[model samples]
Target: MTSVQDFATYIAGLPRVLASAAALFRDVEGRVLLVEPNYRDGWALPGGTVESDTGETPRQGARRETAEEIGLDRTLGRLLAVDWIPGTGRPPLVAYLYDGGVLDPGDLAAIRLQETELLSWRLVPREEITDHLPGALGRRVLAALDILTQDTGTAELENGHRVG
Candidate 1:
């Protein structure tokens, strides 16, 4: 497993912000996958910073992150959107969003979360997501879901402002 110190070093070596992939998985019932952070109180999508030495494509990174975080091996879907999360002390993060589909229903029942970073995992509706997730992350999750589900007429940000 990669440590935060190692990740920070990797980020420091990069010329620009590090690119990452987040897998958005939805069940037939329209419940999306969310993970609660053990270190933090809010929920977030199952993902991680893209490793420089992994030799995996962004889609592969998304698959690996989903399995590691939520124990799922699913078919990856469209390259939804890329987001630039402002950096604090470290470099900013360039996150690639991908649409992922659940391969097996049984995997959902047998989820074994990696406890170091995650506290628990769930498949909940968009309406309930706001309750479990923090403000900005929750909005991003819902926006990504809307883009994937085609629920919103426009795939762009709801407020008509560009996402940096």
Candidate 2:
């Protein structure tokens, strides 16, 4: 019979995907809200890694991250997009984007960036999304924008590219 340690090791060896969640908040003028991370060169949506270990759902995680990062407590809407990013000598990741709803002048004044993790927050026009976000993130955001416009369904992407 297999030893207890061996069984545990077998379970541990199974593949796992790191999951992350983010929110897409828009301004009155339809610009997307992007936060500049202190640890990264480009800007990103207002969200963070999902606490799957805590049994948190993607929608809940998105709300939590938005509250933590921007100090804005708001209810998250539907799932905007889901992307499975390929590994680059590292474990692959599954990212979720949720609709955070539009922010008016009052909401805009209430934003308080998480000082430690974020450098600053700004509203970027949709056309300049590529300039703010790098690589897959730019594509992911664009896909999300399209979904919002369609009001149809969620987008499934692989490394930010739409997949069947």
Candidate 3:
């Protein structure tokens, strides 16, 4: 274990959790933007798994996922929320949510959905977010929005429930 190679192997063998990052985009009217993924049942924010193996941070992963899923490459805003979700039959997951800011009409018009992954995109008001996102995911998005509406700092969550 004293050798560098031994340390490397030890680190590689350690248990790891899955991580994902997403952007909370909003329209000028304050409607949250959601995307329908072809590979999933419910709608979701524009984001995906962080490429930790490639040295991609959660923030970078959010921006990348936004660009890849919706074709918007703008810089993301401050982190809104972080949620740790317990896995059902797999590794636990750490989900990062970032502020995508309010999109202008032109920005909205410029959206280009990634056909291979996304089915479509739409703007949903806060009240209807649950209808689209559902479950812990919906609650997570709501917590992020609360941070924006209240001007509070970032939120820490466990399974979408605010912890501290």
Candidate 4:
């Protein structure tokens, strides 16, 4: 019989791609929420990599990342988009974008950026998202916003574009 330790060892040695989740929050006037990460020159949506083998779903990871990065405890409304993107030297990744809902003045004021990994946070107008986020991510945000507006269900994408 295979021992439990052998099974655990086999699983740990298996290669897997990284999975990340982000919350797409907007303001009352229809701007996207972007956070300035300390490690990157450009801004990105509030999110992080999912903890593997932790029994945590993508939705849970999205909510947790939003709270951790922006100090907001609001509920993530829906699954706006899902993207499968490849990486340079690392494994490919699956990214989830959740609807973080429109924020009011009070909600905006309550945002507190995580000082360690995040330098600051701001609301960028829908048209100006490209100025902040990088290429694919900027496109991803724009596509997500489009999906959000039509009141349609969700968008399935590969590298931020519609797959089918």
Top candidate on lDDT is: 3
Error of 4 at 103 (Å): 0.5
* lDDT of candidates 1 onward, in order: 0.73, 0.92, 0.94, 0.88
Clashing pairs in 2: none
Residue 133 displacement in candidate 4 (angstroms): 1.2
Comparison by TM-score, 3 against 4, better one: 3
What ordering of candidates by TM-score runs from best to worst? Answer: 3, 2, 4, 1
Residue lDDT tens for model 3, 1-164 = 29999999999999889999999999989999999889968888999999999999999999999999999998999999999999999999999999999999999999999999999998999999999888889999999999999999999999999995
lDDT of 2 by residue, 51-80 (tens): 999999888888999999999989888998
TM-score of each prediction: 0.74, 0.93, 0.96, 0.91
Q: Residues 1-164, candidate 4, lDDT per residue (tens digit)?
A: 99999999999999878999999988999998889999968889998888767987888898888899889977788898889898889989999999999999999899988899998888899878988886778888988999988888788888888887
Against the true structure, whose TM-score is highest?
3
For model 4, give the RMSD to the true fold: 1.8
lDDT of 1 by residue, 1-164 (tens): 99999999998887776768888777778788888879876777888777757687777888888888877767777776666667678777766777876535776787779888898877888799879765555666777777766743323332222454
Please report the TM-score between candidate 4 and the true structure.
Answer: 0.91
Number of clashing residue pairs, candidate 3 = 0
Give lDDT: candidate 3, residue 143: 94
Backbone atom clashes (below 3 Å) for every candidate: 0, 0, 0, 0
